[model samples]
Target: MPRRLFIPIIFLTMLSACGGTPASSPSEVASPASTESQLEALATTSLLADIAQHVAGERVHIESILPVGADPHSYQYTPQDVAKVADAKLLILFDDTSYETFLEPLLLTAGGDTEFVFAGAGVGKRADLDLGGFDPHLWLDPNNIIRCVENIREGLTHLDPTGAAVFKSNADAYVAELQSLDAWIVEQVNQIPAERRLLVTNHESLGYFAERYGFTIVGSVLESFSSGASPSAQQMAALIDQIKSSGAPAIFLDAGDNPALAQQIADEMGIRVVADLHLESLTDGAPAGTYIDLMKYNVTQIVTALK
Candidate 1:
């Protein structure tokens, strides 16, 4: 019942319904090349794809399964995505069980000698968090991303040992940028008074961010990492009370998810909704278009609202 397997089943059904023949026989179907002559990396999400692009540089071609603004928590796979997986030389997944529920079957079926690397695997999994599971949003912390970048560099080097030097150089430069970003965030966040450094988000997606930037999460309307779940009336009431008690300036929400509930909570609490946090996805060619920009945007918003 893996969602990824459903794509091939649907494709075969469509072919049968049309009485159409495949151009190539099953045995003759193109498989991923075992030799790393050409490097193709399939990343599970755009955020990871961006980081991989930084590490791979010109040595590899990178493609992402999730589109910009797509929710990784509820992304669905398609036939085209299956072909992308089948054609890649390396497959990089978040692997904190983030994509396992959906991408596991496609990965298993099409991985054929493909170098599969779990980018977050080396960061070690955390299972005791209170978001119904561990929080998989490790990329929110630049320090953690530094670790992820190292994992990516190792994965790329393993696939193309000849270009190992280039991968290392790229990773070093990107890691430096991440370090700078972390320092910059600390400086900017310091502008907010300690009492105002409270974050009340739509979901518990800002745990890593709060932990990194010295902000405390007062509460979330939905007490989970994903926005797919809705808050009950009791939960909503509790969040409103927390916001009022903690004096959180605004309720932050990601772009794609509906902000009605958040807006309602803000209205009842006499606070504002901070629509500037792009927690789950990047913006399309905006100031917050890239992962770096996304962090800058969120920090700016938090400073503006909380300070």
Candidate 2:
């Protein structure tokens, strides 16, 4: 079996060793295990999966459909993925249609038996809300993440009532951590000269991050949030002009997405391209393995590059 399948198998074995019921297959385990009474959660991406893990603690089993290094913007569903979704007792996805175009069809085909939660739903409003649609990357802002964390806690509590206390405790602790991170980010960003607090990125994914951190979004190489959309000549020209005028030091790129366009833009405008911000997905084994680490790494890189 592939490593992905093998890891879950090992995980299941460990669960079994603890007297939890063993799942016959990943798909067969979505329902609550009568023996263990644990809810099975299927998160759309690794970012949400990490958050769900913290919220669920030992009460639920959480799995992510898109593996490490996979671009959520263009991910396609496989049969195995469909099975996993069908098996899940609860599902969590980042709203705003970032990478979930495949989800509706999968859910329709699989039926609506599974409870679904949109983590970004009902979160704080976006500052540069030019997204045309929702920006789905709500977790970019620590305050917004507090909402997402609350939603995850609610969903888990609803699914597994017995785990309500644990979920609440975990959510409270995580929210405190997020609050500390927000304060630290504000402090760190204060070091950057006000004029240098300009962010230009491969896409408009940083609007919330910039809004939260007081950074000005100079412009994006791609005019839209989704990487599927490309910029027209006029947009590109405008971005180049913004780069020149704002004196932004660097452009950030998603590690899994192609950076060629960002590179071209940087080359044309003579700006630096900061590497591997890990915007969409967490790296397999790095400083950005968790959502908190990803945010910390990004903020550190942004502050360093700008300073």
Candidate 2 Cα lDDT to native: 0.76
Worst 10 residues of 1 by lDDT: 4-13
Give Cα-based local distance difference scores for all models: 0.75, 0.76
lDDT of candidate 1 over 216-250, digit per residue (tens): 99998788877777878888888878888888888
Provide the clashing-pair count of each candidate structure: 0, 1
Best by lDDT: 2
* Candidate 1: clashing pairs of residues: none
TM per candidate: 0.85, 0.86
